[model samples]
Target: MTHDSTGLRRLLLVVADGVRHDVLADEMDAGRTPALAALRARGSFHAVTSSFPSGTGPAYVPFLMGRHPARVGLPGLRWYDRARSLSWAPAQARSYAGIDIWHVDGDVHADVPTLLDLARPSLAGMSMLGRGAKHGRIGRSVAWMLRAAPSHFRGDLLGWRRVEQQATGAFLSRFAAVRPKVSVLAITSPDKFAHAYGSDSAPVRAAIGDLDAAVAQAQAIAVRDGWRDALHVWVVGDHGHAPVSQHDDLHGWLEAEGLRVLAHPRLHVRDPDVALMVGGNAMAHLYLSPGERTRRWWPTHAARWGATLDALLARPSVDLVATASSATTVEVRHATRGAAVVQRRESPTGPRWSYLTTTGDPLELGDSLHDLDAGTAWEATSATPYPDALVQLSWLATAPRAGDLIVSASPDWDLRARFEPVSHVSTHGALLRPQMLVPLLVDLPVTRPPHRTADVVPSALDLLGISCTTDFDGRSFLRGTPVSAAG
Candidate 1:
């Protein structure tokens, strides 16, 4: 951790997976995390919103690439990439028992480079709960495992405690020894435990306590042996989790309703049946396969798409259904709940959007048709509890590989594929607040109020005194600093 004034500065970023802002606040207030509380006092703490779909992939993509998943070429946790002939899904990683060590189609490099790439010589990523090993030396991971061998041997072989230990080691190695410009340490216990046992369970709280202890250790190492005052630390949650009181077999329902449910995109299909390509626990991508139905009959048979959307909206478990009408327009409908149409429009300042409501609750876009400012769009979505909901979904709905129909499940229920083993007790992947709201705390003096997860990256670049060379959907919260982008 010894360095001269000429080398790259170091930053220690800790991502506490699945821990909600409110939950973290409660923990800090209860004095369960004294060290974390102290850190917050020395810095800024704001409730940041996660990306739309609100799943790990979408959330992580923003933080890493400083862009929305759709813009970065990563759509969701599960999506079919036609160019690569690959599909990102849990079934692909099921054999690993929630550990996907290898990169999948969704794990490709983005159009905009990530913090890992931009911050050269950076040590980033963690391996556990299917998070691919992007970078960082395997030796440190092994050392952490060895250090926690006694606890793993005694009991809790694959528990959050082990994850905390590994995180501690990762922080120590990166901040104290390697001293990279940007070191990302992810603690994935709260998310995993919350899925097994509800988000508000005692076990989840205990996991937070363990994370707090780990944070304490990491901070002590940074101050005692690492970069000390030079190290800028930011702690955040990928996405929040909500208790799922009910499980919806959207795939089963589609099958029972006489629709074919193909888990992934099939290169060739002879049948005329409509199919469903499911994504996360709360969203499904419905599309007609490449066949006579898609090629010839589909153009004249617009009713098929309408009927499918209608049927999906009729489902008691569904909350919202959306699709792209054009390159810049999206229509979002909720059964009897509400409906709205949003379109991207050119503005004197920049590219903005217009929103109009047809009927029902408005779902979040409000009750009138009006133009919206690009800079204030995130705040609008946050107010609606639909973080970047309009733009991101619009990209997916109109994408070349996008499904004909896109659906979001109700908060109380989680949408799942027919073949999934079981539904989680606590889950994410929706526009609702419980899943969208996350914690963002940084030691640096930010210029603006942080609102979105993608803001973290530009802020990081600001902290490193580096200029961004990519077009990021997110802007820096730090004032006067501009992040550049390569066309």
Candidate 2:
């Protein structure tokens, strides 16, 4: 595609949630998604493996910025900040006393340049459509720009198809009359359908069909309006989904293990023995503490607790174990601060576990147990000896502080203390391949192609003819080569 400075290519990014590659291929072969299949025939389509801990927020941010979660400082869906002594969940930022956690400096904006930033003067508009509460931040950012300049404005917050139809109709109506240099549209019906139903559910299939029709309609609008040559339509997804039979209630399990719940007086008044940390689909954090502890009883208690945890892992619901020693890196922040903790181990036998260490700590540093106050500093680490073993156990291991141990369970097994008959029927966030590997499909109208997620940024920059000075870990895949494509 040839372009001028003012007529540079218009990129449209459509995100479908939890749509897997295999599922798409199966659908295509069965003649389910005609629009997507047609696009594939004209260009190319393949499954691009997403980032680890393959959840929505972690996956999509990288695709937009062309970087990894770690590089963007969005390590996972939820992150615990040692300095701030707080646990940050992008999904729940709206509930955080009016604090917009998504805009926090290091979370989503560290090294990433959004498509809006890249489009610059040539950029006509950008839009994001999705269901999560976190998506509000994206809408807010777009609103901020629109308020600054009414003419340089085009955006939408069409969360679902109902809203999407209205918003898209408005966008197309306006753009068709006064065509801008570029206009971006994001459709999210496919992902929403997959989450409520399974990947193969009839409803999900119908949603995909609807989305395909939407794509066709949008393409037709572009073509008729003389914008087809300038428009580059791309369909992508944050992550794919798998059927989940079990879910782990980390909070309930911790409470049963004799941990004392702390109360954040300002946040909530209830005396919570364990804080149930929430992330998208799967994975949670458990913070615990006990009223009293001394150096004399620490080691014996830690070892005994670790053994009990290992025994618990032998259950069908349990899949892996990462002792404080195995899972994370620990660093003591201060003399008064506690020792760091990290530990993890995969289950080798039946109910085999794949213990992948997560990138963030799960506890909030400062909180109160009963009437006693405790340091908020903490870490995730292995169960090895430390210079100050007592402090390390207190900070990292769930046992020393809460009289309970934190456990990470597999998707098949629901970890609950009471073993309720009714719980979550479906879950995600295990260390399994299905849960960890997400799909990415990028359709760029160019001779050169990129294979890996890391390559996406440089490739995008190259498409825009921008200076490639950023030291991205991903390299661009050479164009016009079969091996360079994603599959």
Tell me the tens digit of each residue's lDDT in model 1 across 1-487: 2322454556767788888888888888898888778777766788888776677655677777777766655556665443434444432211112222234223544345778777766765452222222346332355655654454334442453665665656556655666667767777667767776777777778878866776677667767864565666678888888888788876667668776555543313335354454544666666555333222222334555667767778888788877777767777888776778777877676667667776754465556545666466665676775776656665566655555667777878888733443347788877777887899877545667887888778877776777877867677887563322100
**Residues 88-152, model 2: lDDT tens digits:** 53312221112333343334543455544554432222232121222122323544434322321
User: Candidate 1 has what TM-score?
Assistant: 0.83
Top model number, TM-score? 1
Which ten residues in a row are the worst by lDDT in model 2? 373-382
Judging by lDDT against the true structure, name the best candidate: 1
Cα displacement (Å) at residue 424, model 2: 5.9
- Stretches of candidate 1 off by over 4 Å are 1-8, 87-101, 104-106, 127-164, 167-171, 264-280, 290-301, 346-349, 417-423, 481-487
